[model samples]
Target: MARDYASRCSLSPVRKTWLAAAAAILLAFQGIGAQKVRVEEELEAYPTESVDLRCQFIDGLGKTKLTQVSWIWEPIDGQRDNIAVYHPIYGQSFPNLSFRDRVVFLQNSLENPSIRISKLRMADAGRYTCEYATYPSGNEQGTTTLTMLAKPKNSAKVVTVQAGSKSVVVAQCEAADGKPAATIKWLGSVGGNHSTTTANGPDGTVTVRSEYRLVPTPADNGRDVVCMVEQRTQEQPWVNTVKLSVEYPPSVVIEGYDNNWYVGRSDAALLCLASANPEPTTVTWTAASGSLPDTVMVDGNKLTVRKVDDAVNTTFICEAKNKHGASKHQITTIVIEALEDPSSAGVVAGAIIGSLLALLLVVALIAVLLTRCRRQQRRGYPSSGDSIATGSGGSNGGDYGNKARLLFSGTSNNGSKNGTGANNNGPIYTYREGCDATGTLTEKANDFHHHHLHHASVGNPPSAHDILLSGDIDEPERRKFDLDDSMEEEEERYDRFGGIPGGGNMLPPAYHVRRGHGGDEEVDVYLDDDMESQRDGSVISRTAIYV
Candidate 1:
């Protein structure tokens, strides 16, 4: 038994060594089969920023010695290329010229196998692959996708968008070259319908064009129209703005005057105001009827008044012109009234003056008629001789003939001779008293005593009784004497009584006579030729005679 036990112990050592070697081989095979490499499926970065693409081993052989590590990039439209390589003992290498200075190993270690790119660009977006070669493990690989996001490039232009029935365009906005199919919208001062058109680019980007149609009114002359672009990755939208300019004709209006106007008393002015897309270039003022005076001044849009007259009544036009079109406003001016014309006033004054002159001429004619009537009242009768006599000179005579001659003297009651002659002593008979067969006498005095005949042709003085008895002593000679007396009296009467009513001098009686036979007895008498008296006494005549 001792010999058998010793041999068994020595063989136990060899069996234990073989069993440990088998267990070691089995663990190594299991580790090689379970090796795994992992990488991120997607990554995101922006331009000019840093990004890390992850490629690392999640499960692999324990403490395996890695020989090689390499990175590859496959672009969306191009072939794959090696970006960088790593050898455990040698160092790192970058094989691709496109990513030479931009790619680097993370922490300068190959265990992680992650690449960090500095200053990323849009072109750098692609699929990245990492490969690893290790001792006891043949190969391991991982893939990651890198996506680059950039701000969209926005552009805008004003285009004529046809909308409604009118052939006019207000505004248009378009956005292009946006990633992830950017949404386009419009924001502006005016509200209207919009039309959108989208197109895909050769790259995986979308270009959006949006057209906004608007009907601009006068209130929307200058306004801002904006086109906004929105992407999935951006927080704030990209925008393109343009100022909209609308073109239209001018709307003209006139100011600075009311409707009430008067000639020669009203002052007025007119101003033109226009609204248009482009400012008005010229403003003109004109009249419809007559031409405006040279004194009227025009400055810019204002028409200033210099003088107002009857010619101011007309239609006024204010015209404004711009690039689009022209417009005009008309105002009719009228004259109400003024003071009376000077010529009419003068005519009225002349008529009043003529009326006053006619009244004065009528008054002067009346005054002349009244003076002539007063002169006729002063004379006793309608005289046919120059002088007048009134007296009581005859005494009553009984049974006298039908005709009797009365003697009178030529002298005035004021004791002054009337003519240029010497006084006569003899009594001159100037009148005859005639009685019919019934003894009724009528006094008839046809001639007055003439002062020129007082000194001539008085040869004898006859007594009153003898003059009454002698009827026809010498008929032809008495007729001759009466004719001469009438001629002399008529010539003297015209010389003294030119403008009086009766053809006789306007003076008092020239003689006084007594009606009784005695010289002391006297009677009152009147010198009217038509008066008659009857008495039963001798007739006597007395005359105050001058020698």
Candidate 2:
């Protein structure tokens, strides 16, 4: 009902359910009209595990009346056969012989008009239709469908028996079903030893059984004989396990691993040397060569190994008997060998490689950081002009010459000096008169007096380039002082006739150039010591104020 309410279904069951619903619903729905005959059917008094065929109809007034109900059966050949399975109105009720003792109509004739049938058979699995007609009016009637399902069977039981018993013993296998056909079997413990055990009767229904007959004996106990039962050809079969106990002392003894084994193994076998009511017994090893492992272990009913050594060449044997008889089997040996560890090497190698890769990555990162630090340090500016001042003596000259030379010789930078008194990395020059800076000095300056005393009285220094006697040439002097390449600004702007913007830009302390006319007092040139910027331009123009 829950499955149907979900409005979903499977192939076989759902088809049958809906078809039954259609038949029953049709009978019920048609009774709504006037003067109609309604049918209600049911079964009574049948054995357990049988089908109860049923149908019911209720009109507007809800009354009950006996009527001639029509019943039909459609064989697989598709022929519709009318069967008087039951008809209360005509003072007659006939059922199919196929039903025989298999069904009983429990419907009461005197007081009730309903037809009830009981006692089910698997053959009753089919569709049955009932049609009820009214008095003096066969035309008006209602019909319902009936379905009978065979009852299921009880579980199967298994039994076991042993070899060589003196007396015959009967093994009985039983299972219950409701008119359900059953098959029985007598099975042997070993493979391919099965017999189609015959049941008591032809139909094989009601009570079905199989038996194993053995004469009275002490050796018949603790042997397996199983019974299996399956209902329909398609149902999954079920089985049982039973051990038959024989009354005699044990014989034909054998012992080994409960499971199977492969080739080349060390095994201990407890063999059966004798068989009888009172079996004979003793233990020992047997083979072409009586070779056995130096190490052998034994317990009450078991043999084991603390270690399985391949050097032992695996062989063991045991002999068994009661007071009756004895037998022997080849020694069973179990083989085993050492297995090397496979994953450890690969795991270790991977770890080593990964560690190396990670360490290399860290080292590379550290190198990059150090290079950046050096670059920053190289760009660091000195706080004052004297930060790198170096002292020097005059270049073999006098007072005015001495002081100037002393000031300008050697270096003002931390590195070595060039001939021009500038830092090491540059082109140097000595003053020459009207000679292009391209010219070389006739001789290096041994005396500074030549340079400072250009307009002085008395003789000029000997290495005299006419530059010493030249006119008041401040132009060349200043031009010679080109801005350092490291300066923040280029030197080109200084050549614009010295009208360069002289002070702070954009913010306060702004330079007002006074817009000096061409006629103004001779320009007072001021060279900024803060920067040697003009590689020939203005003083350095620091792009943005640092502080």
Candidate 3:
């Protein structure tokens, strides 16, 4: 019915043209929406693996029709070639001989035709176009880029070199046979520079190489260096560490010469120390002034003087030689007269010093003892030429009233004086006042001495035996005397107990003393044959008194 209406309705030429152009524009928009093709623009696969190059045709409104589909290989350096084809009548076909056995069409339909290629090689990496022939849309195509990935084998090695002034290769790193060229770099604190180079293989793989350069020295030996390689196939950079080896000539040093080589010494030796990469081949000893002395012996790097003498005094040269070079060291020897044994000299000096120290200590002890004795005597006795007399009481000869003239022999006095004359032997302390306690007697004597000293100031100081005594003394001085007296009493007790307090000695000395008792005084006298007489006609005795 629409066709009959269109034929009956006639139009002018201009109107017909306008209607035709509108119809054509409406059909083009419909074809654009009805037919669409899709393909992966970029794909990646490893070598020797299979990959699907997908191609799909979409028909909207069920109006667009597909006839045939084909895959074309567009190499980067060559013209296009048909690799795979599919048609509704002819089935699947592959024309390229290289991919004839490895490629196949995935779908038989003309709408969605995809090809799978197996056992891919590096040469197969290029652009591929999926072309489709349709009923109304004519030819529709999409392109895909197939990329092949190949991992490179990386390795690094160190080069052994002799020490030199010029720069040389010390280490090398390589990334071999990769699909894309790999980048190489050197890493380390070896203070060296690196250079990179590339190589092309016939199989479309690239090889990258790098070398580390440096002026190597002996100090650089066993130094660590690293090489790194980066490639598309690896997620992380490949790393390798290596150690460099360097050789150098010998360095020499001399040892074992203590500069104490004296005449008549035995078994003295000098040693030569040499260090080198290659061991030293020879060691020789030579004299600087003349031939080696007869007493000297040479063995390897050691020179020994069996019996040292005046002839052994000379300069010695030691040369250590190797294939690389030679190093020399020298030492001069000086001989002297035979020296005494140091141990003997040390012993003699120590003995002399010890004797002198002991003598000094004894002299100091004697001086201290003499000073203490003089101080004690001054407190206990009166000096020479001082006379002391009893105070007058009732003018009669009572026990404490008589003007008695007393003569006392003290440690500081040569003799005693009385109204009769001088007496060589007399009582040292004569107290008319009787006291039962020794302490009370000492107190009374001290008081009497002080009182008499005050009264006798007009003349010389009164002797304790000549006047009534008064007591007035510093508290500190009195305490000091009390302390000295207590210490002396303790020492006497210790001596009586055989040098160990409260213990008795099994064997005692034969020395003896007889103590005489007066009214209030202690008189001890020693009568022994070994007594020695003094200038005052009194004898000093070594007496031991036992309590």
Candidate 4:
């Protein structure tokens, strides 16, 4: 009862008044109130799917005498038709029309009358009114609006066209034959304009088509364009992408010419490059003035100059041909006078580097020699109160030969000196005097002992002949002889008191002295006959020496 009252409240005043009168008459005859009737207020379904238009009557007042129930269709265009009906005695009836076999009552009785429609079409979308009539009460009806949905077939494609100034169709998108039209939109990274047109089908379906227009160019080739479609049947918008193909004639470019070609230059070449959708078929090289010179050699797109000369100083032309069209490029050649050889720079650089390295080597050698000389000078001479022994020996024999030795006594006392500036405090130096003497260390020591003892016998100091040559040899005389290179290479032997033992001597500074048998003074003398002076003012003998 409450459901029937609510449905009546939603209707117009005329409908409410008619329902109130029917309820009053039913109450007056049977002493029972009106019963609730229900029908789906709204219904939705897709194409070819079954849908149920529900209509039920509740006899809360105990069978208010239901006579007949019928299903009616009321389209939005005001066209009406009776599609289904149910009666107690006449049995189920589906009208003999478009919905004859496709629609029927779910139950063959009037208690809960509902209809099911099969093989539904887009035109089946309309208002369905389920009407009921009885002997006591009048008609009671409920209306439901049925909505149909469809998913459109979406597609997009790009059209190939030659490059032109005027605008033309470059891409297209379509959403075909969808219930309740689908919307289409164009999008891309490129710039263009699009137009949309819609058409309605006889079966109540709509088709939408969109075209994109743009000025075509070669640069637009392979660019992407997007098509987006929206419809009621899809949860999200459908999208498709297409690449544009724009064709054009061949474009040519020339490369590899520096314009510094000289008369004697070689290995000069130029290349011709062409860009097009279809690759170039033929490449030709020529001279702008006339035929190509004999100095030039052409290989496909490349032109090489064997030897740059006056003949190769003409403008060069390169032509490329393809199916679309032909294109050409040219470059002028300027030949200058032959300049200095390029390799000369490397030769001069190498020479300068070599000279600097040679100078550096010489300077390093001079530095090493000077350092050695200073160290030798400092070590060769001993100071006062110091003793030193220097000698040179060879492997020629066990006998000593032409030995030059220096011996220092640690005596600081001043003593009488000969013209050779001999002093008791000065070290004794042995001078070579060309004398050839050969003996072993012991024999030489014994002989020096005998000679020094003979000098000590007369109480006479060592004479100048013992330590100096006959006359002072000048610098020129010192360098006049060939000095022995192995003077310092020989072995030198020392005595028990190898150095001075803090003792004073009556003789002048001695040369190459050693301890004799019986603790006597001994000296290893150098003979002047076998001696030669070096450029450094030092004397060396070619003969081997001992001790």
> In candidate 1, what are the lDDT values of residues 1-547, reduced to their tens digit?
9999988767577899998999999999887566467788899887789898887765533677677889989986578899999887788899998799999988566678788999887778789989888767678888888887765667777753312345355656555655666788888757756788888765455677777677766665567788887887778987888666666778899887776555554367778888866789888888886577564678888876665566767777888898778999988776667565544788989989998898998899999998776653322223233222222354333322212334343332223222111223324433332334333323433232342223122312223223333453356535423433443454365464343376533322332121322132112222233222223211222221111
Tell me the tens digit of each residue's lDDT in model 4 across 448-475. Answer: 3334435633334343233223234345
| Among all candidates shown, the one with the greatest lDDT | 3
Give me the overall lDDT of model 1: 0.60
Local distance difference test scores for all models:
0.60, 0.41, 0.69, 0.68
Our tally of clashes for model 3 stands at 6
> What would the per-residue lDDT of candidate 3 be over residues 392-456, giving only the tens digit for each residue?
11111222211112323223232222111111233322223334312111212233343343343
Model 3, position 17: C-alpha lDDT score: 98
Model 1 lowest lDDT segment of ten? 538-547
Q: After superposing candidate 3, which stretches have Cα over 4 Å from the reference? A: 1-35, 87-97, 100-112, 136-138, 188-191, 216-219, 222-225, 263-271, 279-281, 289-312, 336-338, 342-547
Indicate the worst ten consecutive residues by lDDT in candidate 3: 393-402
Query: TM-scores across all candidates?
Result: 0.51, 0.25, 0.58, 0.59
